[model samples]
Target: MDSFSGSSRGGFAPRGGRGARGRGGRAPFLTKTRETNPDLEKHPLGCLIKEFGSPDLGLNPVDLAKISDCQYVASYNWLNDEVPTIVIPGKPPQWTPLQEPQRLKEDSGQYFRDPNAAMYPDYPMAPVVNAVLETDSEFDAARTDVFACGSTLGNLLRFARGIDKAFRFNVVVIGDTVFFMRKDNDPREVIKDVRGFGHTFPEAYTTWEHSVKGSETHQRIIRYKFGGFSCLVRFESDGYIPDSSAVTNTTPANTAVGQGDLFQAFQGATISQQPTINKLGSLKIKQGGSPVPQKSIFDLKTRSGKYKKDIDMSDILPQLWINQIPNFIVAYHDGRGLFEDIRVRDVSDDVQAWVTDNSDGIRRFATLLDKIVDIARSNSDKLLEVYCPGKEHLEVREQYGDGAHALPADLRDGLDGSKDGDGGDISDGDEYYDSDEYGFDNRSDDSSEELDYTACSAHDCGYCGKCTY
Candidate 1:
């Protein structure tokens, strides 16, 4: 991160561009930067935070090669306000029955125990237990989330992988559920979003580091996410684990939906429920399926057959995002500021040179965002409490008693520059796991594999939304 010779200070640039005085003088939440393009709609990490690093380096097409080597990662942010009943089906206190846990043989030679027995509060009125009874969101009492090992993040290893991989931003899983707020055409608002993200997923996440007796101990776990979110996933030659609900290699029809892409993010929600989609009738499956009931948001003249507009998405660039797994823990963040965390296994003057040598725009930029995001994730924990709307569900939180907060010790120690038992030295240098191992690439090697975007039937007009062939 030290490689940049200019402007790489703090979280934002001190002067130049945008906030000249009034207007709140630089948004307290956004990291500001210099930009020329006016039509960027929106980029995942906010706007391009300042020219990546001076024109001396020249501009590179936003070629997503950097994240290609990304092995595993995740994004976390806390949302305030009640859990938003509109998103939950049937409004209040609606509970879905739990699924039966499957019995599996364990090397321990013991039958797999049901988690409902080990984790749920035995007390009938336990806060969490009570809250569940009052909230509309459904859950399988035996399984709180899809990823069960706890922390979805596991110590991963990547040797030398591939080169030509493309990079991605956040993995967004679109859903079928919608916040049915109104009965007619009207502006909709969002209090919280329900984007589900997935990766190999940790069974659970633990703040305390513990060693298992003659076994692989874990501290984190990931559950199946419900909306447009992301989770880290990796492919191993020795074994394969699919991230989506569909079977792997056996169902190409569902491959796109199951491949951890943005569309798949909508696991439980649907576009058909959106006012725009519901009115257009584009919400239903295209190839042909069981006929579905029709819906609408308003009694507009258009719905009265007064207007007609044809749209095509057959050719938009198809994208999927994956997080860069922490190869070597270098720094971390707390609510107050950024800290250091590193292990002693890889260190020394030579290592310092190696780190200093690779310093550039890419590394510097990623490191800064890393600190900023870590801080956000840390603070979010406070905002992410037991979400129970209405007085009846308050007991759920009371029972849970507000879960605790703790960051990874090794990661934190590595970020604290002066702390000793802090695991490793932060000043030594930044070390990414296996340079060639992380990053993304087009999913297929065959030139014949076309982009999944919808193409307009119009001639030579390319990707324009509407063009006649």
Candidate 2:
């Protein structure tokens, strides 16, 4: 990662562009307020807390050989509807290369809604687990050590290396798999307002290419082994390229879902139930689209070309490495929304080199994961919250209130043979502690007061709340 250069407050210098605004300029963007579950805030701090300790970075270099090949496990799409609709093995947006320069619209409207919660309102992680079981019924949940999203793992990696801003996530142990659930105030809460072509460029670039059109987002699940632990990671894919061979051989018949059997049961359904009527909540499962190999999937970014600024691969390699995404697309616009320079590069080598060079940090990251898992497992409640105030040590505390479960009662029971069947109701736990016992200070309101608006931009710091932009 590039070194941050700027104020003593740890804010980085603004990368030059039309969107650059100093401290007194217009606000970059802000998270929208929405009515969320009041219980979310009511979840109290717990007495049992584990402080994040630095691991010896010099010892036990991570075994790169142990990093298993990423396998395509399952996928789903969030359909645009009043109710969340999910299609299994749902198609990702096809990477249709642009032919000419075009003036794209400035991004407008809600930008960062949590697709997981929007699609499966009851349980965010349920769809991934459901899709995994639906794809491979024999999958051994016992052997899987960690189940996480790219965002949570990335936060952990940054925290282990002491490079990230403060973040919080919930951890739940289902069978042997410790799920790191990304917790936000509201699943539908707007993360930020649109300000640039980051959203619009992709809109003009990719095509849905399948019957599952009007899909809001595409999410994929992949399984791999890292540092001797089997990890199942779920990430949102930007888009995908069509395999030439598959495109040539695929016929309309192979890609079409039978009219009579389109919507199938996602929960507890076998392959034979390809067209079953069992519905899991408001989620509608439909199978379509041919599977695209991992190599064809890509991550994309749009940058300003006014200053001839190049897209920094270093800033994004960590994300690609975590997801094992091989391709990257960078579109450079001429400040006025006209993009003429677009490059699609296969970054597999660059990502590999980054892994080798960052071996020390990677080892520490692996160690951090081990420590977190151990802490969660040792907890009597088997539910914990990982919280880090900006530039501070991590706190693994007992879950708030009657802790929330990662999956519904049926899914939880099916996952680990646990029959504490409450149908996914938030139950109050006996463990509770005063915040002062752990010296916990509420700093949530401090971010806005300390933000350096001039030094912040969506491309650079993502309005991380600490540095006002």
lDDT for each of the candidates?
0.16, 0.55
lDDT by residue for model 2 over 1-469, one digit each (tens)? 2221111100111111211101111112212212122233544566557885444323334574236767998887655544445556666766554444556655443323355664455688877876666566556688788999876887777776667466677899876778998776554434343354555555555656435444556778998988677899988777775542333211212222233221221110111111111223644444544456788887666666666545445546777788888876666677667877766667777778887877777888887787788887777366788886644577888776677789877666556634234423212221111122122122211002322221113222333111111
For each of the candidates, the C-alpha root-mean-square deviation to the true structure, in angstroms, is: 25.7, 14.3
Local lDDT at 304 for model 2: 63
lDDT at residue 262 of model 2 (Cα atoms): 19
lDDT of 1 by residue, 268-352 (tens): 2121111111121111100100110111000000000011111111111000011111111111112112111111111122224
TM-score per candidate: 0.18, 0.73
Residue pairs clashing, model 2: 402-427, 402-428, 451-468, 452-468, 453-468, 453-469
Report the alpha-carbon TM-score of model 1 versus the true structure: 0.18
Candidate 2 residue-pair clash tally? 6
Q: Give stretches of model 1 more than 4 Å off.
A: 1-247, 250-362, 368-469
Model 1 weakest lDDT span, ten residues long:
296-305
Candidate achieving the largest TM-score:
2
